[model samples]
Target: MGGKSRALPPTRGTLIERLRDPATAPAAYEALVAAYWKPVYAQLRRRLGLGNEDAKDLTQAFFTHVVERGSLARYDRERARFRTWLSRLLESFAANEHARSQAQKRGGGTAHVSIDPESADHRLGASAPVAADEVVESFEREWRRALFEDALEAFRARCVELGKPQRFDLLLRADVTEVPPDGSRPSYRTLATEFGLELTQVTNELHAARRELRACVLDALRARCVDEDDFAHERRALEGSDREIER
Candidate 1:
């Protein structure tokens, strides 16, 4: 995904480098929080069996602790992917918080990330509790969901900037929306009619949108990586995910 097409604008440095720098830390931290807070909150709710309010409070506290304590600086790319490292860090934080028997006040932490527990909870629906063996699996699923969501938003903004908002609309309808009960996607002919475009134009615009979305997703994934090797591993994992989606 990070290979050629750029989804996000260029930043001053890698995620870790920016986080460690006083000048760029705020923006970097904001981006980090936006990307992972949902996944963290989901894990806290599902994996730890915490109530909604508790999950939200602990999510805020965990991120604040990470920022204030400089704990992420200890992450070693050689030891694990940043996703794995962060998940482990969350596990440790939650365990300690439980032991202390006091949840930190929500929105009271130094971290600048926004916590939207209601939205996360809504997305999770009223599913049964996640099994212990599936905690990591569920967390990674939320992570991928968050990654694509951010990329889709970025892609939409890019489309609007290009003065082709209809392109995003078509992509959203044809690909992003849930399939029909019959498992059928809207046909290009149907989209062409709905958007008042030639069938060929529909095809071309969708191709461009998908291409851009792929680039955007890669850029998002790359931002979280520590190095080229880390990016390579993650890109492979993402490609595997893509294949699964295709299947």
Candidate 2:
């Protein structure tokens, strides 16, 4: 998602700003919700290993539990990485799925969900020796995907607000985001012709869009890591985990 778009990338300053006052800005929340969705869904998928429909239901339930139980509101940066804290919460829910099922059968008041603990045990390495490779498929991996999607959503919204909706779409199509490259990408002139915008106007729009996008992306990344240095470390950890699974 961190692709070249002839615009400056996000900086650390803005990331700190958004993290400090997320409720004050819709853009910040958008970036956040986008970022965490993946990790959460990934956790649910691994835990349930259910049919698509069941997985979707449990995913929704997990998110609902997180929000309703004040998960985000009570988050503590000092106590744990976001992933670790959430993993615990997921384990709680999974371990109690049977109890919840009974509650449902009795029609009592509780947000019942079939959250099985065996999957959680597997993820947490509580069971007999399963290769570390087997654990990479857990929800932690989705953190990256969610963060990128949130930033992209914010970028798109910023473009529309600035009356350059089409140009925003062009940014996605013109650049292959999966493998970002260095150097000047396509110019406004090319985008203008392709999207039928005046050259001068495209330049202005691109400039604004790029600036906001950089901020959004960086903030998304920052919210999910320890710091800039930790960001690289977390990525390395992820790489090692993936490689382990491959082997």
Candidate 3:
């Protein structure tokens, strides 16, 4: 029998480590913004009681500050979770910026940061009322949602690369949503008929696709951890919710 295959290296690294490396910092910062901007924007809007436009500008400015300051590189993994650290950082930045905006108004000078309101709305939806105490919870929720979305996209791309697009679609239809698009749920038999495969084949393909998705998600989460313990903690936090893979 052949020995077990070695696990592949993670596709990326923790944001802090990436920010420290000049070669990887640019791409890593882009990924960080894509993964985090929504939550950060939403949190800012809610916590600061700012209008949509103001929130958007501040969010853009925050990312600019991060890039200029190499803020992620300053994160100490032992001190706090990245999300916690970021929430505090954003709060401080928002307060300081708000004060600066007031000072600028007094001096009659204007400052602006370009942000796409439509994009922000599409990602975060209509602004809902959130209690001040719940801001942290809201940020964590959005962060997890974004992380899962990234993982799902990565899984889809991997499926395409592996020539298993049908398998990926089948799994999404079967496990992620209602297949019939109506009141009734579809069964293995129904899926087999729809996909023109044997019932056993349908079952096998879905199983494989789900396994691959789990691996992809794990790899994503692993990239955010600074050490084995951090990775394990994040894995539990991710899998601890209602979004566990269906058997």
Candidate 4:
């Protein structure tokens, strides 16, 4: 099974190494915050029952703590997934903040970490409250959603680079979304007629777009995994029993 699996990229270790290096820390930290802040904010809102303003404040504070305190240096890739490690760190930070009555009232200690309260509110509105025992589950769910969103953005940029923005739009409209909303699928013939193309062209472009999106998703997942084994585990977790990749 292992022999059939694709070789995992070294992005995860490379990112960690960059975070640990003073020369590269600033840029790496920014990337980290961009990649993760949404899930962290969502987790805070769902787990601790925080409002949008407080969640945004705490999200910024968490990243600020990571940068200023060099807390990411304590990450042990051998011990756990980076996601788990960061989640634990966030939980501890929230606990400590709650312990300080003044800090709790003030929202958070860091002012430099800016998050969009409106975006957080929109996300919160889309979901029901998660049970306390299911906070980790909630965090993982949000993380996967964020990861796929990042992949979709990457796919969109690639489509623009390849001069096929229309193809991407078609793929999203026809395959990704349920615009019909009654479980009724759109036909390639109809899409081809709408776009003034042959049915085969619509089919081929949709296939290509799907393949690119899948690759982008895998690339995003590779960036977050601590190692090859961790990558496999996360891929399984994300893809479930439809495991196209071997163990």
TM-score of each: 0.76, 0.47, 0.70, 0.75
**Clashing residue pairs in candidate 4 (N, C-alpha, C atoms within 3 angstroms):** none
Ranking by TM-score: 1, 4, 3, 2
TM-score of 1: 0.76
Q: Candidates 3 and 4: which is better by lDDT?
A: 4
Which model scores highest in lDDT?
1
**Model 3 weakest 10-residue run by lDDT:** 1-10
Best by TM-score: 1
List the RMSD of every prediction in angstroms: 7.2, 11.2, 8.2, 7.5
- lDDT tens digits by residue: candidate 2, 84-183: 6666776677647545656777988566444467544444542232223444345455566665667787788777887877767776755634434665
**Which tens-of-lDDT digit does each residue in 1-247 have in candidate 1?**
1111223435656788888889988888876776677788777766555656666677778889999997988888878888888877877776675544433345344534334686456435535666656666777888898788778888888898999899899999998889868878889999998999999999999999999999989988876675677778889898875244543
Candidate 1 regions exceeding 4 Å error are 1-10, 49-53, 98-126, 241-247
lDDT of model 3 at position 221: 69
lDDT of model 4 at position 66: 77
Tell me the whole-model lDDT of each prediction, alpha carbons only: 0.76, 0.57, 0.71, 0.73
Tens-digit per-residue lDDT, 80-187, candidate 4: 788888877777776665566456457755434333676466556645656556766677878888888778878988999999998889888787776645666678
